[model samples]
Target: MSRLIQDAYTLAKERYAGLGVDTDQALATLDQISLSLHCWQGDDVAGFENPDAELSGGIAATGNYSGKARNADELRRDLDLAYRLIPGTHRLNLHAIYAETGDQKIVRNELQPEHFASWIDWAKANHHGLDFNPTCFSHPLSASGFTLSSPDPAIRQFWIDHCIGCRQIGASFGRALDTPCVTNIWIPDGFKDTPADRAAPRRRLKESLDQILAVPIDRQYNLDAVESKLFGLGAESYTAGSHEFYLGYTASRNDVLLCLDAGHFHPTEMISDKISAALLFVPAVVLHISRPVRWDSDHVVTLTDEVQAILHEIIAGGNLDRVHIGLDFFDASINRIAAWVIGARNVMRAALLALLEPTDRLRSFETAGDYTARLAFQEELKGMPWAAVWDQFCVQQEVPIGIRFLDEVKQYETRELSKRA
Candidate 1:
């Protein structure tokens, strides 16, 4: 099977070379793109701090999939297994709720880097990086359906402090791992019904964000981002942190990155179209790639056209270095490890497809007003032997190729996950 993968790649290389595409260079470039895998997928966003609490803040993970990680140790173990199946090295995105504290009751505001010391050590040993977030939902303070934009000053201050703490913890991860950590803030602050005073809430939110980001962290060890959502389970009528809100805020600050979630928009909207425009104002951006079924439903990612288009934008924008790619989805119906493996591999597959394209050729045709040739070449790329190159990449990365990975997933499910209960 190894020899077969190599032989197929050899033939694919020649075919791609005829079109001025270098498969070898594409593979090398793909190897350097590190995806930040969301840790919530392993455990349904119910972290170790208080696992049994009902998911609040409009966040819900449906289905009773077996083997959900119950504690930090188990979650880390599952991530280790999932990483084995994925081809390139990646980072872990952690939320404040995942903090580990034995018996001591430290609230979110008082949380410290020591709480995540184990995570940093693990990342350092494994040669991985870590990103972070402030878990503004699923807590007592957020029961009012507002966090940073809460009417209560005390509640807003609590969330503000929590976000500041998360930024510090993210810095610790970067210092320990020697890679900058992007600490993003996403709060569920909106109204279910129409609000008479919409402007007041946004004004409050803007002020709250100002306080939260007052401190300047070094860019080498920490970066900041603001995430916005169109709506959530409860916040149907008005989401204070809309796309326009964050875009303007990020543009004004010039130091923060705007986070764009694929599902956090109108059904008709696409992030691929926004990436280019956003990059013009902000120096960089953080992408939360998710699949929306009917609403802001976090379904496991598939290799759909949206996924390919998003990758194409990242590569073609000539700003791949300024973008941070992260996966944001959770499916409680299927094997959780397979969910991670499938999402990560499909992202890499899409990236490889984008890379294998002689985009320069398409660009030249478009620049020369050869629109017909551009369309013809794009349609032809669909039939290229890119899968062979993908298989060889997996082979080189020492991961199983094709559906052979499913067999390993099944074995691990039976062997390790079944024993969890």
Candidate 2:
């Protein structure tokens, strides 16, 4: 209840009301949209299963900022702080490699719901939802640079079983938490150099996907999703699961969702423009929001033009209800907790900006062939007092009202993260 915050919010509310916009309604809408924060950011994608395992899926987390979480407990502790810094209640996205097996030797294929019992319990206790992903990379089984689509039947079977187990775990999360968990499958099955034949591998990918999804989990418990990529670190030749592949697969089966990752496309191509067209055919989509510089770098997300456009498409296209939004960036170059806070907060800001827009008025102007006014209104929205309302939101959510949250993170760093070194 700082005087400055209150005065700014009151002025912002008045300014928005003049544009036929209800700031209150916008904040309400923003509150309802929950973000699924990725767990990998806490530990630079090095899970508890084997802290030494290298990221093999053309995936990498740059930087060696001290205090990377070494185990599930530490990671959860870090995540607790991060969620508290964020404004809304959000879910945690876990990878198969993060399983806590204590001193036992367990492989991906043999993973069970019991292994993730602690996570389920944590989610329940904290009122947070949980999501799952199968670790198809960073294993001896994937040393050949192919998985699921590998011509070797044994490797394909291994990955298939792993995915089946992950889906079941996702269902367990949903059943336990009463929130349908989205189990998404993304693989690094491709050749570093151009391959002689591409058709055979893709056929194998489709078949493997079918076998993995054969059993029907109650949509109420878990939903299936497939992610695609144009290229990868070693898979520059061709990514088996290209955008077209998953788009067609998910479209063919309404049961599965198509995952459109922001950093998975060409530098010039944007996922924002594809959301509208993809939703026309696919029932729903899982959005893995990220920032890419020249390639799929998986940089921290910011309130850039592309990010804003992505949010606008979701808010304006009326696709908000069908899209599952999750962040997908890992920057180990800075404080891990700060990385999470920056990416998540920037995304929420973009979404809040989108929510505050006068979309109806802009649409009507466009429909009436009033291009000049449409563009003018769109430009004017850029200068609106949205940040004031956002500050108010952070205040209401009881999180940090400004960069003051960073002070808390640094305190934690000095009190805890610094000791890890």
Candidate 3:
């Protein structure tokens, strides 16, 4: 480690000590939190099977960034590069569409664990835990923006079968790695124009989900989750699987999780408040951390106020262990590797910042009705030398500090990513 970084950390540690915060404990807690890196970012949500397929269901990658992975090998290579730049071990979240079928045209319903055998092998080799998602978008069946909620029984059955298969695959992944794989199901079932029969579609969706969950897999290997969206590309008027619907569904069930995407709610509604509320009823919670500009744009996550607030609530609520953290954003405008590094590092940074706070002191002040002292201490804590501690963490992790990681990314682009053409 550099002498300057070491000296800065010592001073910062002393400052935090005065606030009744233990720097070492904070760092240890930060190290234990693993943010699952989304695999779709490297390829702009364009999976390996079909290159010509266009993104649908409000899913879009804006930039025509160069160096996108053409195949699974290339994608894994880029992910390894990004993973190296990131500190600590993490999990990789994958969609079912990313499966390698080779010459076979295996339908989603017919998908088997063998299709993801390569991913399991790769994850095992790299010490990375894996998470799974059922891709209900960017497919022909979903072009209508309805999958599980379709009025046609055949169409609904097809999607139900696909989700059932995805759950088994998730269980296989968890069993292979000995860690529970969160199998999340997100569908683009909604209407661009307001529907007169919203009730019908929601009823069908409930039936479809009931059938999907009929086949129970062991929870030891896999946990089921349903994701909700406010609105999207074609489905702007109404989303069948709205937050209320999923919240109610999760509350009724014991095995499922309610996924709260930051970008999936109204602009004014912050998910930081919802975390505690949802966990109160549901068995647990799953988070898809992303930044939304005006809507559900799925922009790359930054260490914004909302992000910090979300982490703070999770820690303060004492539900960190019950909540699963995953990143869900795709930005094709910049270096994909850099996007991963920046987002993952920001999450870690936010966790560290939250950890460094004297939560007990603030809570005690609030309980004692000292609002003035509580507000002052909270505002003043922001000025602490948190950055120095973060930099020191980078030094300890043996990863690049600050802007240095970007230099390494540029080098990789020249020697590796540029040659994709």
Q: After superposition, how far is residue 387 of candidate 1 from its true place, in Å?
A: 0.3
Candidate 3 displacement at residue 171 in angstroms:
0.3
- Which residue pairs in candidate 1 have backbone atoms (N, alpha carbon, C) closer than 3 angstroms, thus clashing? none
Off by over 4 Å in 2: none
Clashes of 1: 0
Candidate 1, which ten residues in sequence have the lowest lDDT sum? 412-421
Candidate no. 1 TM-score: 0.99
lDDT of 2 by residue, 2-77 (tens): 7899899999999999888999899888988888999999999989888897788788999999999988888989
> Can you write out model 1's per-residue Cα lDDT over 270-389, one digit (the tens) per residue?
999999999999979999998998788889899999999999999977777999999999889989999999999999999999999998899999999999999998998999999999
TM-scores, each model vs. reference: 0.99, 0.99, 0.99
Count the clashes in each prediction: 0, 0, 1
Q: Tens-digit lDDT track for model 3 on 41-106?
A: 999999976877988888899997789998999999999989888877899999998999999989
CA displacement after TM-score superposition, residue 50 of candidate 3 (Å): 1.0
Alpha-carbon RMSD to native, per candidate: 0.8, 0.8, 0.9
